[model samples]
Target: MTALGLLYPGHSAEDDYPRIEQLLGSDIRVDVVHTDIGEDAHRVDALKEMGSPERLAAGVEQLRLTGAESVVWACTSGSFVYGWEGAHDQVRALARTAGMPASSTSFAFVHAAAELGVRRVAVGATYPDDVADLFASFLGAGGVEVVSVRGSGVITAAEVGEWTEEDVLTLARQADTPTAEALLLPDTALHTAALIPTLEKELSKPVLTANQVTVWEALRLTDRRVNAPALGALFTREPIVQV
Candidate 1:
């Protein structure tokens, strides 16, 4: 069986991961490995503390034990707060420690955008404007253009994690525009994996959410892909032909 490891930071809306696992069914499994987080709030200094290189390295060994072929650092803020190059080093550390393919949620958004041929994109985030801006920068560094970004000013993932599907849909409409090829919701704090299809329908453009892209990137690293339309348009891409 194919398995992708998700190295989750504690401050995430974790329910989203299992939902993806269930939707993907038994042929593939998403194994979640966690790192320490001191508090659930989104203070920059505090978040930085949660994702130290040592903690990330610890999680990699755990995921390797669980038989995960590839791993994603599953928190957006947890990685992006480190800046673009910093996030790259974070994943390199994970791969170096685990001896497997590795990536982070911030990079996942970049990879997902490339999959859909999206360059200029709008962002909707659960973080305060300052925190959210860093993500837009991360995307820009990775060669995806950031058309615009609207932050919800949410102080905690605990709060965003509780948002109803209606709330996510509303954010999609508010964050998207005709100029952008797609909308990016950048927070694992928000439960968005199940809402991807509806968000795409409402905007008539692809929606890339944190956990959704994290899972997609993890699968891609494992040299596997799924064609589940129910999960969202991202899954409907033509499977990568192995060399």
Candidate 2:
């Protein structure tokens, strides 16, 4: 079995891993190690602290001991809070510490959008506007253009994690614009695995969610592929080769 390692922050999105593993079928297994985030007044600051090199490295050490083939920093805001270069450097640090290929949910969004040949995308995030803008900038640095971004202004991942399908569908509807070829919900705390097809059907375009892209990115790192129709267009399309 191919073991994909995940280093997540706090309690958010941990359950999504099992859902992803099930979608991947019986061939892949997801092994996860979580890191604690320090308390802070602002959500961005808390995410930054959770994704800080020191904390991430510690989690990487734990996942490395699990004999994982590839590691993913499975926090969207946590990874994107540093901007593009910082998010890149964060993955590099994890790879170095784990001695394996590493990626984060932030990069996953950029790459997943690229896979669908979506140059301009509308982004809906379950974060404060400032934090959402940082994520849009991170995608921009990766050469994907964010046509528009709508943030829910939700303070914490824990709060985002509690959002229902109705909440996500409403935000996604609000985020989609005329020029957008795709829609992005960039937050690992979001549970979008089961709702991807529904969102796409409603929006008449592809909807790339954080956990979906994260799993796809992990599969890409290991050169593995699966046909997950229920996951949406990104999973059904051709595998993306990172340039």
- Cα lDDT of candidate 2 equals 0.85
Name the lDDT value of residue 227 in candidate 2: 93
Model 1 regions more than 4 Å off: 239-243
lDDT of 1 by residue, 92-155 (tens): 9878888999998889998888887887999988888998888888899999999999999899
lDDT, each prediction: 0.85, 0.85
Taking the tens digit of each residue's C-alpha lDDT, what string does model 2 give over 1-243?
888998877776678789878988998988978887666223667778888889988777778877799999888888888888888889998888889999998898888888888889999987888888988888889998999999888877778778898998999999999899999998877878889989999999999998888888888899988898988998798755667
| Total residue pair clashes for candidate 1 | 0
Q: Top TM-score: which candidate number?
A: 2
Measured on C-alpha atoms, candidate 1 has an lDDT of: 0.85
Rate residue 73 of model 2 by lDDT.
Answer: 89
Inter-residue clash pairs, candidate 2? none
Q: How close is candidate 1 to the true structure, as a TM-score?
A: 0.94
